[model samples]
Target: MPRSPGGLETLDPTRQRQFSESGYLVLPGFLPEPLRARLVPEVDHWVDEGLRARSIAACAAPEAGGPPPVLELELAAHGELLTHPPLLRTLTQLMGPSFVFHHLHSDRHAPGIAGKPWHHDCEPNDRGDPALRMIHALHYLGGLDEKVGSLAILPGSHRRSADKTALAHLGTGEVPGETVIDRLPAGSTVLLDSALFHTRRPAPDGPGGPRYFIDASYCQTGARWRPVKPYWRHMLARARELGLSDSRWPELFAERHFTEYTGTV
Candidate 1:
């Protein structure tokens, strides 16, 4: 298939090395203006609706009716944003030829919201090969400055041990090493390995503050697994429309199966 336009076809050798060593890479103006302009209003409307419905505390509280309905609305509304051509192309380049969307979420933090605890995405998983499991794309819809809540991450932390003690420190809100707060302007994107230690600090109270961005995760699909239903049919149709079926259909529709081994006791 013809790759999407707007994303870098090849990372510089320096960047490739940096990504290999640190498990993260920051690209300036990753999302072009046209795409960002299309997505921002949708995000703003969702956040405004959330603010109107309840306070930040209410949304954060578990008993306050599982994540305000707007959260889901925001997610569903931005589904296309998750699949933007440039972003998808870059991800394809990084993760090889095939991958699937794992999850999509939107985080809108108004004034008074508590900062998230620092932690790695790998904490919830027990996979033997965590490195190849997942990666994330965080899209900034508005300016993320120091005053407003911004993502802070520990570069190269993905290689660190996911031990109880380390997890405890992060859970208790201990600042991790060499914090880098992503100060991206509106329309930029940051891609990071899921295993990296990171969190979004709450926005400070004031006028024209920062809000959380839509964060989407993707993972390499395992052999014999279909990440989404009707995967083959959907992609095949898409590939045909794009004139990619003849060239890329096979790789796109490839599948695998494994047999279980059982022995008599």
Candidate 2:
């Protein structure tokens, strides 16, 4: 792997080529153990205290909304994870150094929770340039396996410009050429080009343990990207206030990278 002088893990040219061709990369045990430990408890608090519900309600009814009482990145460990050096380095190698923070979501999915349909999560940009990339870093805090279910992705699907849910007809059913990621050590992370088609498949055995998952996204900075959260400004502001970028990634929290928030319907 070719490493940048910044001392962060760099993707080898081969791996970078694979990501461009496949639209995803799996980094096993990407999150350091200590950080993973802190995040697990914080996730429990986020879900147990009804913050997750409130956050969803705010987004669903942004017109009737107050800001979410606590955004996911507002949590200390999450804030740290947002700027984790190795992850950022990998992202830089993949998306270039000038990328803006898009969003962060934290959740602990119970064993019986239903699978998500085949879909892509690429947000729109004002320039409408398909070449501009948006990537999501999916952190599997407790890892994934047969008991916890799996993630299935269509390789190279991101190359085509398509609607986020163009593959909805498939639901979570298997697709030709799909790659299923079912096993990883604790603290693994999967990086995906946001436009790639993916589906979540629940454990087939009908019961299992909770899955601790956190997903954060970033956009290659050139044109402004659309904001999914109505309170997008506040989210950026909070990230800046907390110095989450560590004075290293100047564009990471810059508001100029986003268009005004048009609530998701």
Candidate 3:
């Protein structure tokens, strides 16, 4: 793929072909220094706050609760990061002309924090057609390496079936034959198909060390968008307050779709 000048090279014909065949590609140091510096601190702050909140909640109701809430920052709140020039340009190239920020969130893997299961971001219930639903961006904040923990993805696995056992084994240091561990420097960003099988490793031990990264998933605007319940309610009220006519409700609420699932094993 031809690298873009003054930007991470747009996935060139060769690179695009590779991605089509392989299911994932890494664009190293995609975000420039200044924007990365500015965004990293904000993401770090949000993750820290989320961790603290999760700790308190766990203490208050240890047995009743499930996993800690993965901190999420809405792009609407982080406008500068969302509208960053180079990132946006790259996204446009990857996803084509029209796309929407379907989801934006960050994860902070503290020491001993359990690693994530291998899973595709979009499954049958939620993903649109694979051809139009192209890329997701994972931005690394803290320095990442094998020891500090990094993302693990299955190359060419996007077209395969979702494996429950494979998901369970990702963080257990038992990667499947197709897996690739992404080792990235701080400020580097990786773009991959959301349907690709992937997982995050737990934080390794060290003073002043933890794994922090942001996952931003996008889909072509032509895809249906689904907001969660609370957000949907908020969107309804916001629309009314803005004096939007009822006719526009469908468009306003168009992106919100819910997923159905069987009981966890």
In candidate 2, which residue ranges exceed 4 Å CA deviation?
1-6
- lDDT of the structure predicted as candidate 1: 0.56
TM-score of 3: 0.69
Question: lDDT per residue, candidate 2, 28-57, as tens digits?
Answer: 998889999999999999999999999999
lDDT of 2 at 8: 58
What clash pairs does model 2 have?
none
Top model number, TM-score: 2
Order of all candidates by TM-score, from best down to worst?
2, 3, 1
Query: What TM-score goes with each of the models?
Result: 0.67, 0.97, 0.69
**Model 1 lDDT tens row, 1-265:** 1223753456666776677678787766676677677666666666666642453443344354433333322333365566665666667667765665544555555655666667766423323554464678877777577656667777887886674235535552536464665477776678888778777666545434647577776665554322322122333334334432233213432333111212111
lDDT for residue 264 in candidate 2, whole number 0-100: 87
lDDT of 3 by residue, 1-265 (tens): 3455664546567777777777776766666677667766666666656663663454355456453443233322344454455566666666665655554555566666666777777633345445556467777765567556767777887776564355665454656566655477677777787778777666455433566666666666555544322233333344344433234123322334433223222
Model 3: residues >4 Å from true position, as ranges?
A: 1-9, 50-77, 123-128, 161-166, 169-171, 203-208, 232-265
| Native-to-model Cα distance after best TM-score fit, residue 242 in candidate 2, in Å | 0.6
